[model samples]
Target: MLDDITELNENTTFVEEAKTIDEEDLYPFPTSEDEPTTKRFLGMTPAQLFVISIEFFFMVLIFGVFFMIVTERMTIPF
Candidate 1:
């Protein structure tokens, strides 16, 4: 075990650290203004738009049924 430990230590090598460090180099910020824009309306993803459509469908369904009842188009049997 001791011989194996010494052999491992002898095989290891050290790397020198950088001589100079810059703040800008650490964190790079892009300065380009020509980034591509998404084609989705109001920046909503397809899944989000689908969920909104489903909610709108239910809203219209409920309101339509209520309107029919108010106008005597549909009657309650009870």
Candidate 2:
């Protein structure tokens, strides 16, 4: 009394046609499909913002290490 709810043994083959180079293609992108768009936030793109964030993070880290060394918080093991 079981219905045909299980489709685990179905054979579905996808046939793809061979693509040829077309002279009429305005932007013949063979490998990449991503298009760069002018999207910005606060006069900076997401990538730019990411770089700035990384730079600021490193700056804070360097300053923190410098502060620790200057304040003599940790002893030099030598």
Candidate 3:
């Protein structure tokens, strides 16, 4: 059932290779086969990153405000 869903979703898997590089060794460059040339942030464009950052900032600001309000209420005398 999961395989069917993954196939329908156009999800493909690739095998990743690991490389060992020593500092003293002259050749330390990663091979092309081991290094996958894929853009990870392709989905997150500049505008999207900006918008997400603003949204996260506002969320943190709202949470901080709520926390401060609660703390103040708890500290005040009845």
Candidate 4:
């Protein structure tokens, strides 16, 4: 009477399910096989490098002006 229902073992059935899912590409991100990765300079992307450079330039300019004022080269009226 139990012949109608086939045996379903957790170990065997889980392995089969895992294999099928692995074969399917339901992932949202691209795999290494999809495209070649690009290299970064100083481990930063172009946009990041541009923003950091701009910040550095402003910091240098502000400090240079302050130094000139303290040395009496450039005067600021009180």
Q: Write down the lDDT of every candidate, Cα atoms only.
A: 0.70, 0.64, 0.63, 0.78
Global CA lDDT computed for model 2: 0.64
List where candidate 4 sits over 4 angstroms from the true fold.
Answer: 1-37
lDDT of 1: 0.70
Q: What is the TM-score of each candidate against the true structure?
A: 0.52, 0.45, 0.42, 0.49
Q: List the residue pairs that clash in candidate 4.
A: none
Compare the candidates by lDDT and give the number of the best one.
4
> Which pairs clash inside model 2?
none
Q: How far is candidate 3 from the true structure (C-alpha RMSD, Å)?
A: 16.6
Q: How are the candidates ranked when ordered by lDDT, highest leading?
A: 4, 1, 2, 3
Candidate 2: RMSD over Cα atoms?
A: 12.1
User: lDDT per residue, candidate 3, 22-43, as tens digits?
Assistant: 4435556766666656654756
Q: Which one is best on TM-score?
A: 1
Candidate 3's C-alpha runs over 4 A off are: 1-42, 73-78
The positional error of residue 50 in candidate 2, measured at the CA in angstroms, is 0.3
